[model samples]
Target: MPNNKDLPVSPFSPLTIGPLTLRNRFIKSATNEGSAPGGVPSKRLVQFHESMAAGGTGMTTLAYCAVSPDGRTLPNQIVLDRDTQPHLRVLTDAVHRQGAAASAQITHGGCFTFLKPQQAPRPLSSSSGFNKVGLMSGMLRKQAMSEADIQQIADDFVRGARLAREAGFDAVELHMGHGYLLSQFVSPLYNKRRDQYGGNLENRLRFPSLVLRRVLDAVGKDLAVVCKYSITEGARGGHTAEDGAAIAQILEREGAHLLVLSAGMNVESITTMFGSSFPKENRVSSNNPIMAAAMFIQSLTAPKVDFRELYLLEHARKVRAAVKMPLAYLGGAKSLQSIEQVLGEGFDAVTMGRVLIAEPDYVNKLEAGTSRDSICTSCNRCVAMMYTPGGTSCVLGQPGDAQLNAQPAALI
Candidate 1:
């Protein structure tokens, strides 16, 4: 085992992510609190990001910033069209105040969007309908994208990357992970057409790759370009690890600066987001032991499968072997041991989402060697907030559990 301390340099060694240089390898991965309202970031959002900055993450990503009105998962997601540049500036400025790179993830929800058709919400997709998880009424309204519409959306991504640069953001990430619009276009199950933009893998990847080209051309080698990819789709007949490695290679060839990998669908549905049927033993996290027992009890009904958990270091190793780009492994990545293991296995960085919601100073504690006690419980209450009614706020940080998000989980 490679000790992080024994390395010739420091674990917090300097590294670059595009035009921005991070002082450390730890990143506060994009877990949104739905802090921004109506596409504009509020004062609370600024304070929240600034807090993460002060905690010592070299870079922090603003999760799922919608690229156009039609792409919003909710009204609270940040908007980055031509009209919203000024609002983004506030977020970028706050991130820079504490010497962290502010990265905005551009996305289009398409079939997974909750926008209203009456509101002229034009959901784009290579095929139609939501994933295998059925529909959420207005949320799954399918809108097949025309060639012209595809061109416009691709242009919008290019333009969004430009606006992120103008707003003073150090890096801009393209959200291709989860079961969002972009991931839908890339999945064989979601894309079933024979058109130029559907069917086989090449056609399935056409839209995302085209958008990447335009965005790269727009960012023009100055801005740091990162892509958050979904390695496991977590849906029946969805994408697999082999499929994702191929996708990562394509993105790398298209000028992606870094690859951030994760699994699961949206947070709107528990089955999709939590990956319920993945054989309980296969999940690695707090739920694993309990799930393992359940699996043993239910072995008669469940098919035999490997016990490798979704968010642990084992999966990261699998992904590292498949892709050459520096990997920012996501999903259940909360422990320092796991972080070091990822680096030792050849992954370049580790990203934490819900962990930061629980412990803002997570990286600081790890760097100081005083952080074995991280606060994230992996109860996934933060995940609940993503689609919880009025909008996602930290219930773990409220009242009875006022300090719940700050309490450390016991290592097993």
Candidate 2:
């Protein structure tokens, strides 16, 4: 058996997944940048990724590229289709010019789609279900996916992978977590079907497994294939850490080049996936009072956690033990020491989202020994702006930024 002790020792050490070799261990985790207008790459999106590439992330993920039209969380999200190839190539070329590898996160929104009626007739999911995100984002109807729908989605994922490869991306990360379409099928909380696609863990793993198979078949040898899966849904009757381990093994078995272990579902544990908090006072300005109240109540009732360094490390470790594939540790990694600690623990690499958002040149800073910690205080202000039309920016640095409305500061 391969030993964790035999892995790369330095955060700056080179690592290989499939045919791609990363300059370092710092990967920019996918955070939805609301910059793709009408599902096309905009200047803002290009700049957002180019800046990170220049800043020194080994690989910067262009977040949330939906496989199909109805599979978008945000209406303006990038879609991996024929028309997007040229734009995606531009985005990838920008990252490559900066001496960084580019990765695209491909997903299907399922019942979580935030499109208008004109955009799609209705949203889709593993089975007929209420659109939880719809309730929050203002749409509230979803149709259960037929077997044909499932097969088509798998094909779409394959096409998306092909598009990512043709676009010059070094890798593609499949978003099988956060209660998106794949996770919707994986989690019992969302998937309620009597067919072979639902019920037990093996049944639940069917659709996502098929999706992974198609993606690998499409571009397995040409580009590295990484999968980000939730370790726990954190909801009763949802997924547990053990289930996550099994899923990780399944992905590894299906030939995933790497596994990025993440946690939480959108409807069940939004705060868990995003380390943001929803204070009672902030709910006053919410367009959906009912959702705001529900979020507030959930926040009060859920486990209280102060954002700490390596928040998801413990749960991720369990997944690490279950699979031999290179695992990218994500969530709450801030300082150089924390990163070193994770490397020391035998995780293949560390993935950062908010840290890079705050300090784009974070990896360069660490290499230069210029700083030990990030400027972000886990304020989650950037997180708030991402949901709005203004796109993502640092609240402290970019004050009066019209996109992030005048909301009170995030709690540390």
Candidate 3:
């Protein structure tokens, strides 16, 4: 029912954040590429990002760059270290050549590390507890982080931001969402400790606040600092939409340059990431039938919601009203109409995952008046490839289809 002319602004318009200026409002959302191996960026990784940049995204975020070895989701996730700086620089240079800024989503996977015992000594979390998703998927061990360990992880975040700057990144987005270490501390579902790092709202937000403060102190003026955080965990006893708004206020007060609003945890709201239907075959480990059956039963009792355009706007609007800082709206942005609607609502920008995976040059096509909607179809098969040895690709697309193979992949 809405058109581009109904909007007062254009998604293609240039915008400024601190000292950096992006060419447009379309940000390539931080979808894991699954191309890095041994914490080093490979040629395939470089080429993949280059294609996104060349496709006309205002900025392309390199996803899941772990702040430390123990914090990684997988053994092969990119780690900020001396050995990987050169390769990161090359990736940044390649993005710049295609006229897009580069950003790194720095995070720690928490208890979600589904690696063998040989690969990781133990998974870390806000408190010691059984991780339902991890336990169901085969992760057998996790440990509560000590006070010293907490401080070390925060310090590691500062060091990661420094590496991002050295590698010529225009921005670094702190990953405080999707059941990661920071989000674990914030959620009541995970944090049951009586220490200063747990309990009430302020206590729960302590570690994440520390990390944000340290990162800002290290590179506040040098590069833009963005944080992608959940507004709601989408379960009882977890955070509500109101809690998310308060968290946004804290991030803005702590000097985050931008806030990318997201929601859902791995357990209850896994469907929040993938609209309509989740690819069960991609999510449940095929080797583990117990995990599959558990997921099936969970899906039956879970909430039923359809995947529609701009699905996250209602929740993101709460954060937008609570804080005056720039905000980037993500989730279910698959068409030119939806993007225009977001900008019209006063959101500073829009980010896309599945759509971009299916059509990397979607923005260019929209700008050229060649297309108004992406053909992605929201199958989310590309998301499955992240867990496999091969890199991410659209399941329906052919081999050598630019960067992401034409086959469908799952996203979570």
Candidate 4:
């Protein structure tokens, strides 16, 4: 039998982050499952993470749990609050029963939401500007956040973290990337304010830093506080790799227990994050005629980048060199060799999204020597399918798969 005894570190090795210790170094990166319909955790969502835990992942992160109702990118997105706490507890208990830790990725959408005009009027962002992403929903403009708004949002994050702790989550990942509310404050392209919250890199990081500090103060001792941020905005005028390293350092100083290194802004350079374009035919369709037409037009102009293994390694390496905090490398990690390489290079963990979606038992298979790499094609079809009523599923999955057939609650 082949032995991993001589390997510097095995992917199955335990890893410590703050007060928590994971069974292994493989983390299921937060992927929007869309199983939470009407902002409540569904049975499908519980089964989803339960499968990952039973399959041998160290931890699985639930994606984009909005800190407040207005933070939702979509109406059906899960919100961390009292009403949902019981449901979230059930989900977390299911994960714990399988012997794996669960994490909640708390975030806010900012100007990237499709909320109806009557519901939001004007979405809040770092600076007032046209909201191209929300134009189809008649949300044409975004409002710059006031000082009170910033403080309120920070408090919301703290409340969310505390709720996650009460709900039994082992960690809370603060989403400060992907052009969301916090990323809006971090990115120069979105944060154009003349005040202390804008201008230089330090100023742009002000609000995000504030949010991080507050959340840590509230729940840092109870749950591992992981901060996921873009190492680069993946666009010409956005934050670069150097800026990402600085951001990592600042986050580390603010008491982030782990830093998840990611890249690309969902608004302008999403392909940079996924490492490929959404297949034209697989572009998410809308029920609204005007929105559907707008989506079709946008599909024609969407940027494309060829997929590659370990696509974010270069950027991650830059951040790794700058901070002493535990780092989790995200993006394009599919093979056992790739995970081993990342850990060897000093990353504390490897986070996988698409691959896990394709094969929830992938880590178990690797440990059993039944597989060397994930069977996932990284086609990103699952990205589009996330908006479907049944939520994300591998197109290659055989018929009758539970995840492929789950009926989630309807969105309001």
Q: Per-residue lDDT for 1-412 in model 1, tens only?
A: 9986566434487776656678888788887654555555655566667778888888888887777777776666766865667666776787888988888888887766555643344456666655332233334446577788788889878878888889888888888867677887887667777888887777788888898878878885778788887776655787777777778878877777888877655532233333333333233321323333333443343333332224445445666776676677666666776666666667677777767777777788888888865666555555445433323344456412213222211111
Prediction 2 global C-alpha lDDT:
0.80
lDDT of all predictions: 0.67, 0.80, 0.81, 0.86
Hey, what RMSD does candidate 2 come out at? 5.3
Between candidates 1 and 2, name the one with more favorable TM-score: 2
Top model number, TM-score: 4
Model 4 residue 243 CA deviation (Å) reads 0.9
Can you rank all candidates by lDDT, best first?
4, 3, 2, 1
lDDT of 3: 0.81
Give per-residue CA lDDT, model 3, range 194-275, as digits (tens). 9999998888988998999899889988888899988888777889889999999888888888988888876667767555
- Models, CA RMSD each: 7.9, 5.3, 5.0, 3.5
Itemize residue pairs with steric clashes in candidate 1. 282-309, 284-309
Per-candidate TM vs. native? 0.81, 0.89, 0.89, 0.93
Report clash pairs, candidate 4.
none
Regions of candidate 3 where Cα sits further than 4 Å from its true position: 1-7, 116-121, 136-141, 280-305, 400-412
Per-residue lDDT tens digits for candidate 4, residues 327-411, read 9999899998898899889899999999988999999999999999899998987776666666777778832234533544222
Using TM-score as the yardstick, the better of models 3 and 4 is: 4
